[model samples]
Target: MKINVPFSIAIAVLSAIIALLGYFIENSLLNQIRSSLLQSAIILAGVALIIGVINMMRVHWVEMRGGKGNKIYHLTFFAGLILTLLLGGWFGMSNPNGYWLYEAVVVPVEASLMAIMAIFLTYLLTKIINRRKDFFSIVFLVTVLVGLLTSAPFLGQEIPFIATGNSIVKSLLHLVSNGAMRGILIGVALGSIATGLRVILGSDRPYGG
Candidate 1:
């Protein structure tokens, strides 16, 4: 008797069995096998990330050599990347210099970008209200304003009525926003499980084999 199987199918079957065994059988050897497999995956992921970064740098470097007008941006990117890596290597991540570099450089830049995004979102809301002028648009605008007011500092402290209103708005936001987030997470988890099942059953071949 002869048994023939595709290499991808064989690997998938083995992986699924090993994963199941790791989960269901609480044996020491099975736990060790699971840990080894996880470590191998992590190492492979790290290698892939490094390769991706090098490839991106090579592409940008090539573009700079081709006299791209965005050479300054590419140069700035490489400069930041190299500086951060060198500082991290030299000072260590927990060192004061590394912390200072992060607080002084990374935090401010991130905050500025977030501020810019908030401004853009406000502008977009204004445009939507002006153009739509519908019931839903009015409701959306009101909701956004209420949300912003609830988050604003000193508004609650200054006015008693405003403080009560902010409290109500915050309660509504927490209830609705948290419920929606939970629903989204549950949906994502279900989708992930279905995909994993498909992959394990050989119905899906993500590796193109």
Candidate 2:
């Protein structure tokens, strides 16, 4: 027997609407339903993550056994994953060791990745500027330049933008961070709504697979 996809989508959409309504409504029943829905969602998300991780591990294990090129990358990945899990388990909740690993290794690695992204963005902007000298391109160039300037000091600036508590620098930092986050989140929300609508209309049968 085929699964009832329409029935499933109806339940999903109803549950979502109830959950949203619970936030604005003052009814106890609505809140309880919303809480149950949220718990169900969390469990489903956790299961999905576990399934994804297992799939990844299986694929990587097969590649490892193939004994082909770049075995070192496979070895490094398993080593790091195992090490991270061991550290987290041993450290428990009050984590000095886990925090140390994150600060020592992860932070610098993430920062380096971000720096590379900025470099690529600048390169892309140069291409855009050459192709089209538009208002938006100019704005993009200016934004990139300001972001780069505020991020680091050149030659150990004697005129550091240091105020009493460097409030000016902090303000600009917060402003930029908040603006970028809001813009990204708004885009995500819009895309999510569009995808959900597609699912609802059965125009996209993601569940069929």
Candidate 3:
């Protein structure tokens, strides 16, 4: 059957209104409606995640068949996917095998990537500091250096009084980081509000535009 776009948009707008009202108002009916809407959203999110996994698998399968990419990577993807699915299905994913796979494979890869990211960000910050010799840039450069030193356990041990966890410099840097994080959170909140408004007005057709 053909879709009713207007009806869908109306329902979405109404649902958003109900959820918003439920956030501030304290009514049993609104609370129940919001709870149901949240459950539906969770279900839809899971469905979307499954669809995305299937799409990725299909793409990898076609590429594997055509020998378009590295066969090792393609086979590895399928092997990991099948293994995870079987393990999760059989043991409900709450068992030791699933935890072992995650800790052994996923954690190390993530840590390596984070190390690489730290190096890249440090390089980028250095470039910025070099290009702009402003007061803010200079302070930022010093703060980043202190943070890097503080994160190094061996070096911090050697320079205990300077970059140790209890050092005044580290405490100051922590406060600065908290202020910066709060500013970022405010910006994110404003951006989300703008996006939600656009979606509610039916101008942002995230479903199909």
Q: Estimate each model's TM-score.
A: 0.73, 0.67, 0.79
Across 1-209, the per-residue lDDT of candidate 2 in tens digits comes to: 14676677667667767877887899998898899999999999999999998898777788989976588888887888788878878886368886666777889999999999988976887798788979988876776665555656646652356332454755776788799999999999999989877755556655542
Candidate 3: residue 188 Cα off by (Å): 3.1
- What TM-score should be assigned to candidate 1? 0.73
**Most lDDT-accurate candidate:** 3
Cα deviation of 161, candidate 3, in Å: 8.2
Q: Model 1, range 1-209, lDDT digits (tens) per residue?
A: 12334776787777777876798889998889888887887899999999999999998899999987688989998998888888888999999885666888889999999999998988898899679878989987887776766666563464343335447667877798899899999999999989888888888877655
Q: What are the per-residue Cα lDDT tens digits for candidate 3 across 1-209?
A: 13677778788888888988898999999999999999999999999999999999999999999999899999999998888778777777678876667778889999999999988987898798579979988887877677777777653364665556587778877798899999999999999999999988888867643
Cα shift from native, residue 198, model 1 (Å): 2.3
For model 3, the superposed segments whose C-alpha errors exceed 4 Å read: 1-3, 98-100, 129-135, 149-180
Instruction: Quote the positional error of residue 51 for candidate 1 in Å.
Output: 1.1
**Candidates ranked, most accurate by lDDT first:** 3, 1, 2
Name the Cα RMSD for model 2: 5.4
**What's the lDDT of the predicted structure labeled candidate 1?**
0.81
